[model samples]
Target: MSLQVIILAAGKGSRLGRALPKPLTELNDGRSIMQQQRDNIYEAFGRDVSITAVVGFKSEYIVDRFPEFNFVYNEQYDQTNTSKSLLRGLKASSKGGVLWMNGDVVFDPIVLKRAASIIARDQSMVTVNTSSVSDEEVKYTVDAEGFIKELSKTVRKGALGEAVGINYISSRDKAAFIHNLGVVHKDDYFEGGLELSIANNGVLMEPMDISDLYAVEVDFAEDLERANLFV
Candidate 1:
């Protein structure tokens, strides 16, 4: 199956306190977060891999800047969260395996390669980083067999690690995945929707342990600075 990379880049990023949208924020290497992500995907999956970015905050900037990739505009991005943005992108994607990533995250291309490999067998996969578990991050608990048991920010104890917002949804689960995203309230994050899918909607979310790879989600100015060092 063809790999479809869906980038969720719709948020205004109020926490970052930047004029540019979070994805458009330039790193020290002079590439925007979104640009870096696109480049990494291309390097790992080759140029034929389909890429669709959900654009909202400064959507025109993204459209004009990255003409090579496809875009799905989130009209209510200002009023909604990542869940809605992701749903819109998912709807706009082609029928194939999906490798979705938060546009704000910066990581090596090896991470995408690993994700692509997992989606080849497993219908669904989620990246987990045991090293970065914190109070602020979304944590997950796994069964003894290593599947996700529970996932949330309030999960304090016995968690494997934080969900890095990079996930793989197989072509087989596309309908259920879309239903899961649609059921989630617009105000909730995409992680909340994923939780609902796992807990209630019966989505089999496998965890891809990525502690060996360097990955960081850029949420703050400090995070952007750290991501600069990463890219």
Candidate 2:
């Protein structure tokens, strides 16, 4: 089976204040953020990958720009959060493991390169940046076994790092994850699903630290500025 990849781009990124979908927002390099992500995916996985984009909020803009990607639409985009959009993406994936990320994140292509070996082992994991941890970003903490214990923006007490919006669910854990994600509130981010899966189903995930590399989740204009610095 081909490697399955997902890009969650269903929100109207009002913070970035862009007329285009946030993923379609152009970087200093001239390629749109999603375009760069697509290029990087190709670089890491070669032509055998199956890329799926979950689109909403002027979906046409993204759809037209990347026709090569398979699409899953989130009709309730305005009212729902990443959990719902990601659930849709997960439901659309074929059997086997899947890697997913926020469409707006701009990162060094090597980030995906590093994930390749670990992914080949079929271990579920979330890429994290230990160098930065803030209330605004999704934070994570591990249990005694060092598997991720808590994951959310509200995490504070034992936060080890910020999730970089890139994550993988192994085939062994996919069904439980999909079910856990289905129970999350519509307003919750997908982190809630991971947490629920861990607690409710004992799914274990390692935190792959890529602190030395750059991965920016472009939530605002300032974030884009920082992302461009590394591009």
Candidate 3:
């Protein structure tokens, strides 16, 4: 099975308080976030995998930085959310299983490799990395069998797991899913669209618990500091 990787880097990332786009922000090691993510994908899937980046805010910066990878511009980035950004990326991706990921997080290459293995084994399955989350953040409720039951933003009464911003989706199903996604509320996030599809179509998502994986997502200055510590 062919594997394609799509990195969503179109957000303005106002929280980062940077002149450049979030993905272009430099890390402590001097490499930009986009470069780190691209390198991570390459390491995980080798050179065979087709990699594409969805660009919008600061698109020129991303194009200048990563000339090797194919880029799809999300013109409605400011008007829409991650779901639209994902739709733009999916439209540009090759017709096969894909490793869809968020660009803000720095992940271990092994996570991508593991997800690819699962997708290759079962095309119907979707993989989401689960990690212990704080009480203030949105968390996903998973059943005993590891299927996502609910993706809630409200603080739950019990334990909850956070999505690590990585996913493995079959392109055939993804296209159909995106088509159905158009019926959902426009302001809903990409995850919400997936949840809608899962609820109505019985699409099964397998959990890949990566609580042990060393990954950092740069959302604010504090997150950047935390990333330095982890890196």
- Winner by lDDT: 2
**Predictions in order: lDDT:** 0.84, 0.94, 0.73
Give me the overall lDDT of model 3: 0.73
List clashing residue pairs in candidate 1: none
Sorted on TM-score, highest at the top, how do the candidates line up?
A: 2, 1, 3
Q: List ranges where model 3 is wrong by over 4 Å.
A: 123-131, 155-159
The digit string of per-residue lDDT tens for model 1 on 75-172 reads 89899988888889888887776889998899877888887668768568889998877889889998767778787888978877899988888777
Structural similarity to truth (TM-score) of each candidate: 0.94, 0.99, 0.90
lDDT of 3 by residue, 1-231 (tens): 446888889889999899888988888888887788888888876777687889899799888887888899988778877788888788777677677777888766677666666776655443334556765444677666767766545537554567677777665567666775576655656777667767887666666767777667678899888777655
Worst 10 residues of 2 by lDDT: 60-69
lDDT of prediction 1: 0.84
Model 2: which residue pairs collide?
A: none
Comparing 1 with 2 on TM-score, the higher-scoring candidate is: 2
In angstroms, the error of model 2 at 70 is 0.4
Off by over 4 Å in 2: none
In model 1, what is the error at residue 125, expressed in angstroms? 0.6
